[model samples]
Target: MNVAGARENVGSLVVHQSGIQCFNCKEFEHFAKECRKPKRVKDSAYHKEKMLLCKQAEQGVPLQAEQYDWLADTDEDIDEHELEAHYSYMGKIQEVPTADTCTNSEPLE
Candidate 1:
């Protein structure tokens, strides 16, 4: 789709990184956008990245540490290792006694 813009969209440009692999051609050293090979049928799941890793293996590229959706990278993995901590914090907050909590009290001797 043609998006009207001043000159071009800067974020769309992917920088060249030797470790980056293309999902389209399953080739290393390029973005899928720069891939010259015909696109394979893209999948909604990570099946493509898995195949991409196979290519990475043949080319001696180390497996990617994590397969992150480029668009959602910022929001994803927010509680990856901290889910328990987050749940404990919420539980502690729920246990807190508010000002309205009734308490049994008598005049202290």
Candidate 2:
């Protein structure tokens, strides 16, 4: 092959290997990975804001509902004091059953 033809082939191979292409900016014959743009916090902030806006757009509607469902069966017979006493008595007590107290006994599966 001619020297100029060989050089062109080599250049093509280099470009393919480097994964370089330009769509937005033409000054650098490469993609965003090889971009020369100055790093800015605003760029990341813009992306975050864009994501939040997209999410809000997805969930556009607000929902409203009653705190308690009136149609559901309500238990009014159990008083608050009785329930509090039952729970408090349970908290103060630890029941070690007398039958299981033996250390030499084999554990029943």
Best by TM-score: 1
Instruction: For each of the candidates, give the backbone clash count.
Output: 0, 0
Which residue pairs does candidate 2 place in steric collision?
none
> lDDT per prediction?
0.49, 0.39
> On residues 29-76, what C-alpha lDDT tens digit does candidate 1 reach at each position?
666656688755533233334444455677887654334232223334
| Candidate 1 weakest lDDT stretch, 10 residues | 66-75
Model 2 ranges with Cα > 4 A deviation: 1-76, 96-109
Leading candidate by lDDT? 1
Q: Give candidates' CA RMSD values in order.
A: 18.4, 26.8
Off-target runs (Cα >4 Å) in candidate 1 are: 1-16, 43-109
Whole-structure CA lDDT of model 2:
0.39
Q: TM-score for candidate 2, please give it.
A: 0.18
